[model samples]
Target: MRHDDDGLIAADALDRVTWAMRRAEWAAQAWKDQRLRPLGLAAAQYTLLINVHSDPGLTGAELARRLNVTPQAVASQVTRLEERGHLERRPHPRHRHVQELHLTDAGREILRDADAVIVEIERQIAEKLGPEKTSQLRALLDEVADAVRAP
Candidate 1:
């Protein structure tokens, strides 16, 4: 007789690769959040800041697409970050209905600090996994992500 995970899918149905990835994600997020807490940044907010910093002119809709989130979600976060003086939106040069995103000086400073923290986190992971394994892990994770994103 085949048994499931007690009202859930069968035990064998929980593929190890997926579970391991999920576990790592949860752990990494918790670790990043804990470290970023002193800097007043959540994982998602830090990600948003990084995106704006990297491109410096993405509209909320564009950001939503990049972040794989809804425009409404991006809007509220943008509003909140703006209120905190972390970022600002200026009217788009060509599009009246769209606003371009930019990080403020404060945003730049905080992002710099947060980046240092994140670098340390990455260094630790690399140290734990060693260089070769770390590279392999990154490639494997990217492949998994690509597979999931592929229609």
Candidate 2:
């Protein structure tokens, strides 16, 4: 990589797009972690909570697929959250050996607080990008996501 006028990495066309995406992901994760740290949550943990919050009854296998982690990893984390009273596992309806994750009352409250923190960060992003660019950015990112997900 070469340095541009501001001593930033000067990437070629393709690398520029990929590098920008990766850098944005890393920066967002770090910022989110910092913001969520005071709530005693890591980015990954918050991700788990938010996903379950979005979908009330997701199994660990489903979560592993969504989070792209191994089953054992999710199981351990889910156990910790259950112990913390932030999450609970309920028997899946009509399933002999399956359980679904759901947020506890405590977990819902935590998600509310965390959403305030996250919303601030998002608003900061929108304010910087402005309405038009932010809208365009969302469309572009979605297009890229669709492309990558397509088989």
Candidate 3:
């Protein structure tokens, strides 16, 4: 007797909420890909840059945990960013084996530009969703994420 918003009968696993979440993720990734193409950055790279900008001195292993990626993956991205002069790995203050990440001046400049692009994209999304609904949606998503992370 249950029907989705489209009037189609929904499967138990692929309900309206799940479908919406999946489509939203796909669309957002596609949009980010298009926007970042000219900047020569992928969504993952941009995410890494943003994370490092926000939390300076994070190690590759820490970034891996925060980004939900493998340490090897983080290392690879770190190498790429370092090669581009976007970031550098400095000696950790306490740990001899761990290297802390630091964004370069070039990285900061590029990150500022990337932030503008993301802000514009977010502005468009907010315009469509309206401020109230957009806030509600963000709060709901954060709550869901927190709940999932709860022990």
Candidate 4:
């Protein structure tokens, strides 16, 4: 092993890490492009819709918290979906000014389509990685997330 004159070893480690991150991002975008693009939904919008549909009757603030986005961002997405007739906003039971979101019939139908796309994506990933390795990868990624968030 040769070291640079600056006494820095593992110079390539940084490059490798950068490459890995970019590769993972590219793979994710590719999957989203194939799965969500034809449905007229961006990946972020699809995720928001799915999350809201799964946790119905949640306020925009609550949804923003769960989605780790600003309330305004959630509101913007919700507004678009509402205009498209996929979702609706109603008065919250407890909050006076806050509105709770619900998926309309069309929203549910779109969600089903999105779910099918997601299922196909998962199946393709599983076929490529195999079940055990896929699980292992998930565990390892979770560990990384935990470590990153640790105090």
User: CA shift at 86, candidate 3, in angstroms?
Assistant: 0.2
Q: What is the lDDT of residue 69 in candidate 1?
A: 99
Query: Which has the better lDDT: candidate 1, or candidate 2?
Result: 1
In candidate 2 the C-alpha lDDT for residue 70 amounts to 100
Which sections of candidate 4 miss by over 4 Å? Answer: 1-23
Per-residue CA lDDT of candidate 2, range 1-151, in tens? Answer: 7545563534465467877999999999999999999998778888899999999999999999999999999998898888989999999998969999999999999888988999999999999999999999999999999999999
Clashes by residue pair, model 2: none
Worst 10 residues of 1 by lDDT: 2-11
What tens-digit string does per-residue lDDT give for candidate 1 at 1-151?
Answer: 7654485757666577888788888999999999999998888889999999999999999999999999999999999899999999999999998899999999999999999999999999999999999999999989998999899
Query: Cα miss at 12, model 4 (Å)?
Result: 4.7
Q: What lDDT does each candidate get?
A: 0.93, 0.91, 0.90, 0.84
The better-scoring model by TM-score among 2 and 3 is 3
- Tens-digit lDDT string for candidate 4 (61-121): 8888988999999989998899988889999888788888899999998888988888888
Put down candidate 3 lDDT per residue, 86-135, tens digits, no spaces: 99999999989889999999899878888888899999999999999999
Model 1: residues with Cα > 4 Å off, grouped in runs:
1-8, 149-151
TM-score of each candidate?
A: 0.88, 0.86, 0.87, 0.80
Residue 24 in candidate 2, Cα distance off native in Å: 0.6
